[model samples]
Target: MEVEIISEESIKPSSPTPHHLRTYNLSLLDYLVGYPYVPIVFYYPNHNDNDNNIFQALQRSLVLKKSLSETLTQFYPLAGTLKGDSIECNDVGANYVLVLVHGRLDGFLHKPDLGLINRFLPLEPSFDQSSVGSRVTNVKVNIFKCGGIAVGLCVSHKILDGAALYTFLKGWANMASKSEEVTYPKIISPLVFPAESLRLRDIFQVSYQTVLKEAALKVAASRNGVQQPTRVEVVSALLWKCTIAASKEAYGIQKTTWLNHSLNLRKKLPTKTSKDLIGNMMRVSSAVCKDNDETTLHSLVNKVHDSIVKVNDEFVNEAQGDEWYVAMHKLLQQMGEIGSVGPTEYYIFTSWCKMGFNDIDFGWGKPSWVSGLIGKGFKGFFNLVTLMDTKCGEGVEAWVTLDEEELKILQCNPELLAYASVDPSPLSNDHVI
Candidate 1:
């Protein structure tokens, strides 16, 4: 199916921002993000067919547009320009695009083509032209021939994270569906991770961009034992094992790989800090492993879970000091030192399981699937984005990145294939006509 861009416009805030809120300060945590624009897609299944269907669809679009403007008023910094270390909230507006597809959304949903998804997105999510250097966001409303819709949004990592994106999106949907009032987000990243002492750009330095061999791994949620394995616990354990196995087999050497998993700190923050406070509120906890035995699954899961559990309020609060920056800089130095030795690699795991993606109702309906633009960077791609099936409440989806050879080896693993199939979407089916 071919996707066509029908129209494009700017969606500005419905009201002018107060002069007091004109300049949005960038936090030290925001500076460390390095401006990677994360692209996410939401597929809403709509099969309405009636005389008023077309008119109703147009009405929904108009409603979404209006609510978006109102929602922008709450997140006014998004509609502004990034200048130096701050966002100039001058109401420059965000890009809004309307797209059309040649076929029904059923086929697309049944078999999602990631390459084709770029057509639905408003802009490319890349780090070259950083969001700080260009636009903060680009949103697209895709209307399929089947009357279904796909909402594509690309958010800059410089000012926002997954939590921020979810908050903004859910707020927009609430307004569109229930005409609810939008709450002003409590932006306090600077207070938590003050930029006064730790200048991320100045302290952190990388001499060479090392291209080490990497692999993506996955595991489904399990319920065999007394305790059902959470998505992050299961996925992290399996992926960590797979990374070790793939690295050793690919290079024919024994090496240790560092496994760093991100844990959200909103819940861990103090009540006064507030969960509603926006910005990148995530901390990374890491573990190193050289063992290749698959029998250690339970131990690895326990390790990852313990690492995540250890990120309590005290841990998050203490991490805001200079020691944290020194630790990160040393970690990078260690990574570089390790990479220079052999086929060893560093893998970062981010699990969006139990993310309440299915709860984001946008009047039409909840999206059948929500996906992140991960692994698009093929060269040395080392991160894993794990998603959950909100309806089933137990399924896990992992998009892993490995070189062609390593991927072929991973595909042959009978152990992994026994429980779950490898990228078995409808796109790979022969029945598609």
Candidate 2:
């Protein structure tokens, strides 16, 4: 598909407030302090039919101008914190939000001209040398010539988790759609009711070490930093193909097993109000190897599903009430004396659709296509799945990055190659931006 590059500019930065952001009240404060950076992009597709114009869509989406910013300002301390020595909002002035506009011809091709998307993917936030909350950059809008638009937002994870972000986005969309008045999100502060506890040892008989090892092994076997695996390479060749094979063997073609991955804890929570939940409250549930002759997809998925259920049971048994919370505090105190720590590895699968970016309608309309840029630190042992809308065409568009050897394996996989060929869409060309 032919592509075009649009101009890049920074959005006006929000100012920061004085005072060190308090983490004591928020449960998810650790996330803020540890991995404060979050990149969010909104995709808007062109409206060939007479849907609402992009601006009208935004107007209908109430979260656009009021509730979102207000929510961010109200609960998320990171939103009000300064970047460097200055007292400006930590948001990097870069139009962290992107808008892409693509034409119907380009959209019909299905595959995104990589050249067009690449141009705007590598935006870095400009930090002030001297500021505290001053390092502010929030939303950015980028428009593509193909009539696709993307709103790129960079937020500090310290403040809001994926669930919180999604909730805010949904609220924004609902408001923008003018479908309802702003409803408050339910806030469940993990800090108020933390998850870990000492009684867990008594409640669940399973060994924590064993479970951690299993999860780590699965991730290690699937991904090694030496070689990365793009979502397409892994899903098409390993995940989906395995599912198909497993389904065929188990219950014939009539029965199929699908993978249902969960978003982070923040998104799944009830939203009457916002809370300061923190830590690795994220959970991911998926079917294991299905296509392999050794195991069926149903069995694999069932095993994982059962394991998750068991873990939840343990969580419920150990971390339920004020007594459990007290036990958890004691456990933390004891562990602190011995210098103990939490698990380092966990898995979660999420799609861009949850971020509300996929449906962002700017003045021009929706984006013909969209994608997440793979940044640094994502290599080796990390399994992050991103989703994008299929440009108007025969098949969908997916972008992934894997290690060299994995790439070779995927290229040689007949099942995967066959699947790729099934889609008549054109392959991506090398155009950045």
Candidate 3:
């Protein structure tokens, strides 16, 4: 799978950002996440008439580039540079690269090499504070030989999260397709959760992946006398269980493990304008298993559920009040104590499920597949798992990255294998969008 860089340019906003909106303040959550970026690619199969495929591809490329320019005007922050804890909205523009893949989309999707997929992204997802250059977003357009296209984006976590990324993409698609519906990005996250001065520590975040089929998910969800577990809940519990086992095997003893699930704060927050509020409006819910505790699926499920429940309306409201810094301090303090007691591991879980990544249709059709990377070739993250919806929209795909030894043991786990298909092809779903 060779990719030729056809062209490179910066896609600036179609219009200039007003002088009043020049400096976009970073929320406390945004500052806390440090300098990572979201790396995702959306694969769209070529559906134009074969006779006009060549011409169609050219025209489609024009539409995408043009629409992206217009979309950036609305998402002005994306076209700016990251300055300290804020975004210098000088309309610097996002780095847009046009690449031509020397292979067909199907060929790549057939095997879908995780390592090779990073080639489609313009920048690596992991970065330290000093490494976070001015650019807030990077876009790469990969045109396959078959006239198919894969749009990959690496947006700074300092400005966007999974939900915000979806909003940005949908807006771009709406412009490209010339759809009647319009997307208005409400940059109210900063106002809602203002940035604060607090001591921050870097927490490593990264991933490796596995796919859990619908049938297996069903069994896993209900296997433990637990009545109705959500897909995310069951999958998180299962993976946590596997990680615990792998750790015990590797270390010859049980180690207390902690699971931190990222919870979207949009709905939980009491803000009336949160529906369209963008940025990293998310927080992690902590669930732990002591070495002596029962680590059954049922127990894990309950723990996962309970941990998530703690991040409800009340908790969010409290965090947003005058004691916000105090709340943050306590949260970080708890995280700092991860391995203090003894041998322990902490895994971070974030779900892109139900975020409508598959439904982002630029014009031709919804993407046949959507993919992302945790932190490839980057050491800032480990023991991270990101869950996304499969193309069929029925199964969950879990991308996890763990230690090499632990990963080897996890790959051979019979229980996990029974439920997950390991690294399967994206076309296995056989459905687009």
Candidate 4:
């Protein structure tokens, strides 16, 4: 799909400020670092209709404002190590926040495009390697010739998670709509810091034997020695089935869900609890699969639901964690007793990209489109999925990636084919939302 930029604005600028040393809670650090900076892509399909005017309206609604350098402040306090020796400053503020108004577009354009999207993914920011502040530089607005608009948000994971960013965007939209004054978002930073008594070693335990054994056993059990797909593969299959079913049921055509998912290495360890953590500790993992058969939306959703649920089983989590930790530990030991070993497999997938962006509205209304790019780093599997509120109907929209072989299998299933043809209205309330 081709994108046209009707207008653009920067919410922050790239700059440094006097350092401010502030200790962050451990729980906040865990949540921040445990989550990856997965880009959110929102697509508003069929931009030609009156419904599509939301995009244009947003452009007119939002009041663009620039802040003083001192106004640039870090929302999440940095970890002590990252804040070492200097008071970190949040002098980085965007020049302006673009308000996008309008919401009519084909849903397909919002789906992930592995080829182009991967190139724009941000580099993982480091606490020690650089200053602790917003790393994101710009935002792009592209209007497609196909009557779709795609809004690309490039934000530093260090500055915000999916939830925070969405809140900001939604607030912006509400303001533009003249609904309410922008409300200050609740800062959950303090909640994620590490407990005073817990040391890094205690909180980030890295043991491999336990995780590996569990993974082996779970693989054996998934299909009675049929060789279970990797975590990426399982989620890819589930999403592909779910989206295809939803599309078929809503549009009467067998389609596919081709998107990516993000993973966080810090949280995947058997010892880690996602409750609270800081920093942008994450990686991207993706898989793609498609189905061509007719299928009810419920059936497709069930398939995706089941696949995701299965991979999170305790045995699966332990096995995946143990195997990953052991392998990394060995690699690190050989590298000369490294002080720290970052988890190689950052959890299996990211739901924030899929679920986090939908609620963002900057006064003009919900975004016509929201999406993110794949970041640079270790290479393996990556997927980015987003939960979209469809204009055609109501229900969650899932995008995923899969290989050709898997895609073929998904398309040929008769059960999936039938499931794709059902209506989504009756089943809309059944979804978790």
Which candidate should be chosen as best, given lDDT against the real structure? 3
Model 2, residue 19: C-alpha shift (Å)? 8.3
The reply for model 3, stretches above 4 Å from the true place, is 49-55, 128-133, 214-225, 271-273, 335-338, 430-433
Clashes of 4: 110
Model 4: per-residue Cα lDDT over 1-433, one tens digit each: 3323344443442244334433333332233243323355554454345654555534432332222111133332221123322223343344233333233235443333345543222232223333444333334444443334455554444445555555455544554445545434443433322223221110000000000112232233345222544433333344444435444554555543323233433344343434223233333222223344333333333344444444333422332244534533443354322213321211133444233455554333455433343322323223223333343223333333323333344445454333232123221233222
Could you tell me every candidate's TM-score relative to the true structure?
Answer: 0.85, 0.52, 0.94, 0.46
Evaluate model 4: give its lDDT. 0.36
Task: Give the poorly placed runs of model 2, Cα more than 4 Å off.
Answer: 1-36, 48-78, 82-109, 114-118, 121-137, 145-148, 174-179, 186-263, 266-280, 284-299, 313-370, 375-383, 387-400, 417-433
For model 3, the run of ten residues with the poorest summed lDDT: 125-134
lDDT of each: 0.65, 0.38, 0.82, 0.36
- Over the stretch 265-327, how does candidate 1's per-residue lDDT look in tens digits? 778776654556778777777766643534366666766776677666776656677677777
Cα RMSDs, all models: 5.9, 12.2, 2.4, 12.8
CA shift at 304, candidate 3, in angstroms? 0.6
Task: Write candidate 3's Cα lDDT for 257-359 as tens digits.
Answer: 8898888888876656675677988887889898889888778988998888778777666656767677767776775685687777888889999999999
Writing each residue's lDDT as its tens digit, candidate 2 over 1-433 gives 3334333444321333324533323332222232334555555644443444445433423234343454444333434444321123433233333343445434634654433443343343222211344333355554444333455665544345555655555554554455544545544455433533222211000000000111222343254221333332233233334334433444443222223344344433444233334333443334333222243323343444443443343343343365545644664454344333321112223433324444444334454444554433232312333444343322323333333333334344454343343223332421111
Error of 1 at 102 (Å): 0.8
Better candidate by TM-score, 3 or 4:
3
Candidate with the larger lDDT of 2 and 4: 2
Ranking by TM-score: 3, 1, 2, 4
lDDT of 2 at 393: 27
Local lDDT at 140 for model 2: 53
Alpha-carbon error at 212 in model 4, in Å?
33
